[model samples]
Target chain A: MVSKSRSENVQIPIGPQHPALKEPESFLITLQGERITKSGVRLGYNHRGIEKACEQRTYIQAMYLIERVCGICSHSHSTAFVQAVEEVAGLQIPRRASYIRTLIGELERVHSHLLWLGVAGHEIGFDTLLMYTWRDREVVMDLLALLTGNRVNYGINTFGGVRRDVDAAQMEQVLKGVDILEERTKYYITVATDEVTLINRLSNVGKLAHDDAVRLGAVGPTARAAGVARDIRKDDPYAAYADLDFNVVTATQADVYGRTLVRVGELLESCKMIRQIIKNMPDGPVTVKAPRKVQAGEAFSRYEAPRGEDVHYVRGNGSDKPERVKVRAPTMANVQAVAHMLQDGYLADVPIVIAAIDPCFSCTDRLIGVARESGGRGIMTWEQARQAGIEWHRARGIDFTRLNETFRCGEPR
Target chain B: MQETQAVQAELMKTFPGLGEVRVPRARRIFWNVPYAEFARVFEAVTGPMKFTILCTMTGLDLGDNLGVIYHLARTSGVTLSLGTQVPKDAPVLQTISHVFPAADLYERELIDLLGIQVQGLGEGPRYPLPDGWPAGQYPLRKDWKVESLEGCKLGQMGVADGK
Candidate 1:
C-alpha cells in the first residue's frame, strides 16, 4: 500500500465557489511544492433532485425538465430523451423531421464548440481570442433563434418528432450564417495552429495518454484529443447523421492543446454538416403525433453532444409517466479523467486542465462529497496561507511591510 | 443485426445457463443474468470482449426485488446491457468497479439511492446526499414514504447546535 502520511504536501482547496471554476465545485488538491501530488473532487452543490423529480412528472412534462439539465446542451438532452421514448412506443419519426433534427443538432454543436473555445481562451489568459470567438459564436446563436424561435432552450424536440418546421426563407438565413461561421472557423484554426504562446501553455500541459483515456472512460473532444477516434455520431449513427458525411477530428497530442485543436476542427466539420443538411433536407411534415402512454418496455438512447456522448435510459410501464429515467451526461463520464490529468501537473495548470474537459458542473452536481485520508501537516487556513506568502517574500530579501509603509508615507488609520 | 447476434452467441458460449438473452432492437442486446453470476459475467465482457466504457448503471425498485442494470460499450461501438435482481430483504450485489473504474460513481449512486449494498466497493461515499442525512432513509425505494420525513431530527442534538 502507498504511504498516506505525506507531511510536506499542502492541501489547497479550490472552491465549491472559486473564480477558476465556471460553476460550484470543490477540489482538494494535495500539492508537494508547486506540483500536484493528488486531487479529489467534491460535487452536489447544485443537485436539485432532478432524477427523482422525473419519476413524478408525466412523459411530456419530463422533456422540459430534462432540457434544463444543461443550458448549452439542451437540444441534445431532449433529443436523447425523446428518442428513447419513441423507441419504447415503437414510433418512427418522419424522414423530414429526422433531417431537421440533424440540422438543429449540428447547429447546437457549432454553438457549443464556439462557446467552449471562448471559455478555453479565457482560462489561458488569452481574452482577445475569447472576445473574437464569442463574437463569431453569436452568428450561430442568431441562426438557432431564427430556426427554433429560441436561443438557449430551443424546445423544438417533441415526442415522436420535432415541433417546428423550417421554411425556405429560414433556410436562406441559416445557409448565410453557416457561410460566415465557416470563414471564422478557418481563421481560428490558423490562429490555433500558429500561435506560439498558446502552444507553449497548452502543449503537453495535461497529458492524458490514449490508453488511459479509454480505460478511464473519457469522452467527446477529450477522448478525440488523445486520438481515441470514438465518436458516437459515427459509431452509432442516429438523427440523420447516418445520411450526413463529415470527418471525425482527432489529434494525438493528448494535451490541452490537442483538445483545443480537436474542438476547433469539429466546429468546421459541424459547419459543413449544417450546409449539407440544409441543401438535402427532404420535404415533409415536421412531426408525428405520439401516444402519451407507452407500452411496457425500455430503451437506451445515445446522442453525440458537443462535449461527448449524452446517454438516456428510459423504462415505460403502460403509463403516461415513465417507470424510470436515467440520464448520464458527458461531464459525468469526463470528470474522473480530470483527476488523472491533474496528477504531477503544475499548480498553475490546474484551471486550464479542468477547463479542457469543458465540465458542465450544473448537469453533474448530483453527487456528494469525496472522502480522503491523508496527513494534515500542510493544511492551513486562507489567512495563514497569505501570511506564509508574506514571510517567504521577506526571507528572500523582499520586505513587503517596509514597502507598504514607504508607500503609505506615515498615513495613520 | 448480425453484430447483435454474434455478441449474443459469444456471451452464451462464454457463460452458459444465462436466464434470457434478448435482442430488443437492431444494435441493442439485453442479458438477464442471475445475481450470483453478475460479477463474473461483467468481468468476461470487460476483460475479454473489451467493453471497457461503462455508460451508466441504473437501479430499479421492483417491489419485492431490486434490479441493477449495467450498460457497457466497447471501443469498436458494440454495447451490451447486463441486468440482475436481488431480493429486497438482502439487497447485496458484487461491484464491477474493479474492472472499470468508471463504475465507482455509478455504484455509489446505486447504494445511496436504492439502499443496495455493493460488496467490494471500497471507500464508497454517500453520493447525491448530504453528510447529515438520516441513515437507512433511501429516497428511491418504492415503499419509501416522503411524508414520514416531516419533523425528523437532523444531525446530533448538542454536538454542533442544540435541538
Candidate 2:
C-alpha cells in the first residue's frame, strides 16, 4: 500500500462566517498530519464602506457614522472623533461632559475586555470560563444601557459636548453596577491567572519577543505582553487619563498568558478610574456650544480603547461636510504582528495566538482578496502572492479602485 | 512677536526645507513645505518636544492639487499641526510610516480612497475599495459623482451582494 502524503491532509476554513468569532472573518488553515503549517485570514466580508459613507455625510452626521466603527467600543470612536474635531475648532469640552465621557469610555472598556476574556476562554475550549465571563460582562452592558439609553451606541455625545446628562436616579444605577462589576472582575481575575488549565494553555504559547513587538508595531495588551511599555493613556493621555491615576501593566513573558494578565489588570484599573470619576466628577454644563460649520483646520485625538490606542483624525473645511476623516485603531497595528506570532508556533496554538491580538473583524471587514495561486499550490509568500496578484490585475486591465468616501469611524455592532 | 518669531526660528532651523509658516486662525498654525521634507520636519520637532504620536493624516482635494496634512501632537501638552501641499502634477509625498508606524494604515487608506500616493510605505493592496472601481476615480475627490446609496444611508453602506 502507498503511504498517504502529508500534503493531502485536511484543510479547514475557520470563518468569513463561524460561531467562534462574531465578526465575518475567515481563516484558511492548511493542516498537515494534524498540524497547521500555514494560515491566512480574510477580512472585509462585512466592509460597510464606512470611509466612503463619511465623505457624503456632514460633520455632525459623520459623528454617528464613526461611532458605528465597532459596537463594543462605539463610544470610544465617537468620543475620539469628536475630540479631534473639537481640537481643530479649539473648543473646550465641558468639565462635566469630559468626566461623563471618561466614565462612558471606561464602562465600555470594562465590557469589551470582559467580552474578549469570555471569547478567549471559549477559543481555548473552556465553555464554563466563557459563560462566567460573559455573564459578568452583561452587568457592565446593563449599566451602560441604563446610563446611555441604548446599550450600544449611546447618542449622548455630539461635537463639542454631550447630548444628555446623568441624573441622580441614573447615577444611582451606575454606582450599583460599578459595585457588582468590581466584585465580579476581582473574582474572574483570580480564575484567569490561577487556573491550571488556563495557565498551561496560554503561557509560553504564541511567544513574541519584545523586539518583534516594537518592530511589528504591536499595540495594547499584545505589546504590553512583550514588555513594551507603550500605553496610549501613558504615552498620550486623552479624555480623563491625564487627570486620572492608573498604572500601565506590563509583562516580560510575551505570551498569550501575558496578554490575558495585562487585560485583566487593566480591567481593575478601569474600575478604579470609573469609580474615581464618579466621586470627583464636577457639576457643570454637560454640553458646549459648537460652531455649526467647523472652520478649515486639522486635528487628531487618541483614545485608549479596549483593544488599544484608537486614533481619529478629522479635517474640516469650514463646511458641514468634513474634508476627510481617518481612523487608526489598535487592531490594524496588531494584525501585522500575527504572521510573526504564528511562525514557529504549533498548529493548535493558531486560534489562541490570533485571538491574543484581539483582532477586531469589524474594523477589518473590507477589501477584496486576490487569489494569486492556482490549484492550491500555495507556495508563494503572502507578500509575494499579493504583489503577483496586483501585477496580474494590472496586466489584465483590472481597475482596483478603492471606494472614495469618509470612513464612518466606530465599532462593529 | 517674540513668541511668533521664536516659533518661526525654531521651525526654520528644524525643517531646513520649510517654506512658509502661515497662522491661519487664532490658535491654528499651518506650515507649508515640499512633500519631500514632511518626515524630516516631523522627526526634527518630535525629538525634544516629545511630539511622538501621529494624530492623523488627511488629504485635501484642492481642485487641481492634493494637499497632505500631518497633524502631530506633543505629549507635553502642546499640539503642533504640520501641513505639506503636494501639487496635482505629482500627488506623491514621503511616507511617514517609518517615523510613525501608525501612519501606515492612514496613508494606505488615503492612497486607496483619494488616489494620492505615498512614496515610502511598503504597500500590499488597496484596502476598503472593491475590485472594479476605475483608476483615477477617487470617490472622495470633489469630481467623482458616485450616486450609490453607500454614502446616503448610515447602516446600509457597503453591503455585499446578499442581505
Candidate 3:
C-alpha cells in the first residue's frame, strides 16, 4: 500500500497461490515511474466450472448449484437462474413469492453495499470506516438469517415460487432492521459527501466516461456512477420490481467517488424498497409445484446484483437435466473496465479503483503485494498487510480516529 | 419486436436461407440464422435494431457441430438471441470485439473453453483456463477427453478417475 517514487520504471506482478490460497486472481502492471502505463488481468485461478456443472444437474438440483456462484449475491444468482427456469416453464409464480424475492434481494443489496463501504475504507487508509460499517452490516445479516434461515446463501428461491414465507413476526423484525439500516445509510451518505480527505483521494481516481462505461459494458454502480441510468430492476423489471417504485441513483463524477455515492444512495433506495415490500406484501401461496422436467426451451435471465448486472443463460432439454447453462457474473462484465480504469493512474490507486467496482472476487487485500526491483519477496496476510498500510499512512499524518467523528444531520465538515 | 422482424426481413433479402424463427415472448427473439449469414445478421441486429448491448455469448456443444448464440439487448430492454451452428471440424467465426469491447472477454472464453477460433481476437493470454493447458483441448466440447490433457491437476491427483 506504500506509494513509492521509483526512478527505474518496470513491470510488477500481483497474484496468489491458487483457489487453495485466500487470494487467487493476478494482475500484471507495466508502470512508468509511479504511474501505470498498461495493465493486464489474469483470472480463473478458481474457475469452479459451475456453468459446466449446472448442465449435469436437474432444474431442482441446479438451483442449489447456481446459488453458490457468488457468496455475496448467492440469492441474486439463484433467483436469476430460477426465474429463467420459471420463464421457460411458463409458470407465473404467486405474487407473494415475487414480493418475498424482491424483499430478500433488497436486503442482500443493503448488506452488500455496507460490506463494500467497509472494504473501500480499508483500501483507502481509513480503517475506522471499515470497522464501523461492517459492525452495522451485521444487523442485516441477522435479519437475513431470521428471514431465510441462512446468512450468506439465503435458500429462499425455488422454481415455481419461493421456498419460504415471512410471518407477521418476521415482518416486524425485518422492518425494525430496515429502520436501523436507513439511519446508518444516511450517516454514510453525509460522511461520503462532507469528508474532505476522502473526496480528494477518490475524486478523479478511476475515471471512466459515460461512453467508455457503455463501450466497456460496465454495470451496476460503475455504469450508474458514470450516468448511464441503466438498472435491470427498472428497464427489464423482473420478480416484483415491476410492482415497486424507486429511483435509479446516478452521479456525474464517474470515478471512485461517484461509485461510492451511487452505492450509498442505492443503500437508501434498497432500504426504502424493503419498507415498500413489507408494507404492501400481497397474500398468496408461497410455493407452487413445478414440473420435474422443463419443456425444451431456453431463456436468458438478467439480475441487478449488488455488484452489477448478473446474467444466466439457460437451455433446458425435455429431460430433467439442462442442455447448457452459462453464467455471466457482474464481475465478468466489469473486469475489462478495471484495465481501462488503471491506465495512466498511480499504481497505489489500483486497490481502490478495483474496489470501486465492489468486485465480488474473493481475493484478499494482499492480492496486491508490491515489491521493489529486487524481484522476490516474502508475504504478509491480508489483515497484516492492511495493518501495515494503516500504520504507513499513520506515519504520514493520516490519523483516522481524528478524521472520523460522530455525525449530526446537518453537521459541518 | 418490430425491429427484429425488420432485421429478419433484411436477412431474408440478403441471404434467403434463414429457418426456424421463434418469438417465445415479447422483447425476446430467438432464431436460427445460417452460418453463412451470421456476420451480416449480427451486424443488422446490432446496427439496425440497436441491440448493441452484448449481454454475452453461449457456446453450445451440439453433437456434431458447435452452436454459438449471441445474446443481444437494447437500452429498451428487448433481448434478441441469434444462434448458428458451425461444423465441429472447422469451428471458426469472425470477432465482434470492434463492435462491442465487452466481446473481447467472452470471445477469448469461446476460444479457450470451447475451441472456437475467433478471427482477429489476436494473441492474448488464455482465459478462465490455465496457460499450460494443452492446445487443441476444449473442455466444453461434448467429445472432449480428459486423458488427452497431459498435466491436469485433478487427473494427476486421482480425483475423478483413479490411475
Q: How accurate is candidate 3 locally (lDDT)?
A: 0.82
Each prediction's Cα lDDT score? 0.85, 0.73, 0.82
lDDT of 2 by residue, B3-115 (tens): 44456667877666567775533323567676576666666766764556455566667777887777665433234567777777778877777766657766876786678
Best by TM-score: 1
Question: Model 3, stretches more than 4 Å misplaced?
Answer: A1-8, A17-22, A362-413, B1-17, B145-163
Q: Tens digit of lDDT per residue, candidate 1, span A1-413?
A: 23355657788989878999999877889988788999988766677667777787899999999999999999999999999999999999999999998899999999999998899899989999999999999999999999888999999999888999999999999999998999999999999999999888899888999999988888999999999999999988888998989999999999999999999999889988988998899988888889988898989888999999999999999989988888889998899899999999999999999999999977775322222256211224335556767788889997767767879752332
lDDT (C-alpha) at residue B152 in model 3: 29
List A-chain TM-scores for all predictions: 0.87, 0.84, 0.85
Q: For residues A91-170, could you state the per-residue lDDT of candidate 3 as single tens digits? A: 98999999999999999999999999998899899989999999999999999999999999999999889988899999
Q: What TM-score does chain B of candidate 2 reach?
A: 0.71
RMSD of 2: 10.6
Higher-lDDT candidate of 1 and 2: 1
What is the TM-score of each predicted model, taking all chains together? Answer: 0.88, 0.79, 0.86
Model 3 chain A, poorest ten-residue lDDT window?
A363-372
What TM-score does prediction 2 earn?
A: 0.79
lDDT of 3 at A336: 86
Q: Considering DockQ, which of the candidate structures 1 and 2 is the better prediction for this target?
A: 1
**What TM-score between 0 and 1 does chain B of candidate 1 receive?**
0.87
